[model samples]
Target: MNGSKDIFSTIFSAGTFQMMLRSATPVALAAIGGSMTEHAGIMNIGMEGMILMGAFFGVLGSFLAQSAFAGLALALLVGILAGLFFALLVVRYKSDEFIIGCALNTFAIGLTTYLARNYFPGDASGNPNLPELNLAFLDRIPGLRVINHQSVLVYLTWIIVILAWLFVYKTPYGFWLRASGEKPDTLRTAGISPKKMKWIASVLCGILCALAGAHLSLGQLQGTFTDNMSNSRGFIAFACVIFAAAHPGKAYLAALMFGFFEAIGLRLQGFVSSDLTGMIPYLITIVMMVYVVVRKQRRKMKNE
Candidate 1:
């Protein structure tokens, strides 16, 4: 009993909590981007591809420029181009959005793999890693250890979340985006172009998703661009957006829940089967999606 208590206590400690927050940051950032696209009525299933491209290019940029910020800038630029390509396929040509998304995912996987193999070669890891924002002075204060030694990007993510919330709820552009999804005709009548809103949303989504990928490859891992490194984080981000009904603030919370599971999986790998542990986040996503469906059905029945 004492041993079991100790194990549980260890699992619930402040260090564990910090680990969970760190794990959740990337997912939360990507989910916020996804939420923006969903709010504008665009189903961006290409998030996985965007993330992959970002990770690949981020490493490439760092390797070539030998600067983390330059790498991030390059990733963001590639993401914008990718977003524009997606917009051309889905919005302009009216290609099947789902098909285009899948193609993008496949293309990203193939292209990144080829580039890593040919150009970068030899593990294809990033050159210069982004530095952490260590606040050693804050360590003098009691109970501030957890907040002091985090990466600068993590703090930036927090600020982005708040700003995203405000952008979605308090700004006119946000209103137009929401209207584009819920009532496109109304927006058009009001002289707001739904296509333009969706384009902007797609571009912004790409930038944010790129940042998330950069966080994974540059910020957290510190230089590694493994194939499929994103590992369906894009899908999980989509789930978060759905779970939160496209609300940025709520989507951030949902992402944290997923991140918590991921953190648990990482922590439990030593004690449990790593395969089973890794499935925790995906399994939880399936369960949450089912719950949403059931709740919607029940509400429909009640209304009827």
Candidate 2:
């Protein structure tokens, strides 16, 4: 009993909680990105590629320019170009989104791997790291103070969450975005372009996903670009989107749940094998997917 108690305490300790916040940031941001495209009838499986590229470029820019902001700017530029290219293929050229997304993932891995091997050529590259902001005003707060000294992106993510919620729920563009997915013909009848909405959604998704990558490489990883650093976070974000029914706020909460499990997994590494511990977050996500399916089936029966 005491052993179990200690294990639980170790997993839920303040340090673990702090790691959870950092772990959740990238996933939450990606979930928000995925939600944008999902609501606009675009299943963006390409976020994985975008994130990989963004992390690579983020590190590249910071390493070269010695400024995190420069890295961020470069990443966003890549994101914009990626979004437009994806739109041209999936929207204009009418290619299969799934195929294109898979291609993107493959392309990113190859490209980043080549660049890393030829240029960075190491386990990690530590550039001018992102600034860690101190919440001095919250010093008096007990538990909150512990998390006060996180990266600037952590603070920015909170504001982005609020803005994303407001933008998706309380704005006219939000209605049209949703309408484009559900009722494109109706939206067209109202003199709105469904294609334009989709294009915009793709671009927004790319930007957010790029930001997620920046947070990972610069904010969390501290300007290190590892091979496959994204580690399926994009897919996890996609799961969050479906679990939350494409709602950004709820998706963020779902990401936090996954992040908590990831932190727990990291904490358990000493007690278990690294491989097994690493599976914790993915296992939790799979379990959640099953629960979602069961709940939907029950609801369907009730409605019938």
Candidate 3:
């Protein structure tokens, strides 16, 4: 009973909530980007590679310019250029999106790993910790104080969530993006280029995903760039988009849920085998995917 109580206390502690938010932020941001691409009829699996590139370039830029802002700007540019490349292949050349996505992921892994070894050597390129803002007033509000002392990325993620939701549901462009996926013929008849809509979605997704990667390196990990630091969070974000059915707000919530599990896994490391503990998030991801698939099957059957 005492052990149970201790476990409960630890899990519900303020530190846990803070960790949850930190873990969730990058995933939430990437998921929001994934939602845009999914709405535009694209299943982007290259997000992992995109995230890795962003992390590498973020550190590289900081190392070069000695300014976090400069690093961020460069990271965004790299992400945008990567997105453009993807758009050109998928939209213009009509390449197989899946093949291109896989190629990107492989290329990112190879390129980043190579650069880290040759240039950074042991991932010690720069120290570019994002400033953490303290919201002391929230301390008086009990649990709300747990959210204080977070990085700018945390707040930015919430703002992006709201904006993404509004853009997807309340804006004309959102309608066009959705229509392009649902009925390209109808969109074409309306004199709108579905390809153009795809380009916008891909570019936006790249920027957001890059931001997510930046947060991983600069904010969450405190400006430390490791080879493959992204570590499948991009894929998890993609899962969140699918679980949320392409809704931005829902995707963010799904990311938060995954983050909670991730926090739990971190906490459990002391109590369980490290290998088993490491499997927690991936296991949960598989379960979530299974649940989504089962629910979808049920709905399809009912419709039939």
Choose the strongest candidate by lDDT. 2
Tens digits of per-residue lDDT for model 1, 39-76: 98988899988988888888888988889888899989
Given candidate 2, what's the lDDT at residue 59? 84
- Compared with the true structure, model 1 gives a TM-score of 0.93
Query: Which lDDT value does model 3 have at 216?
Result: 86
How far is 145's C-alpha from truth in model 2 (Å)?
2.1
Please list the C-alpha lDDT of all candidates, in the order they appear: 0.84, 0.87, 0.86
* Cα lDDT of model 2 by residue, 215-266, tens digit: 8999898989998899898898998898888888899898888888888878
Q: lDDT: which is higher, 2 or 3?
A: 2
| Residue 263 alpha-carbon offset, candidate 2, angstroms | 0.5
After TM-score superposition, the amount by which residue 182's alpha carbon in candidate 2 deviates from its true location, in angstroms, is: 1.2
Sort by lDDT, best first: what order?
Answer: 2, 3, 1
Q: What is the TM-score of each candidate against the true structure?
A: 0.93, 0.93, 0.94
Error (Å) of candidate 3 at residue 273 is 3.5
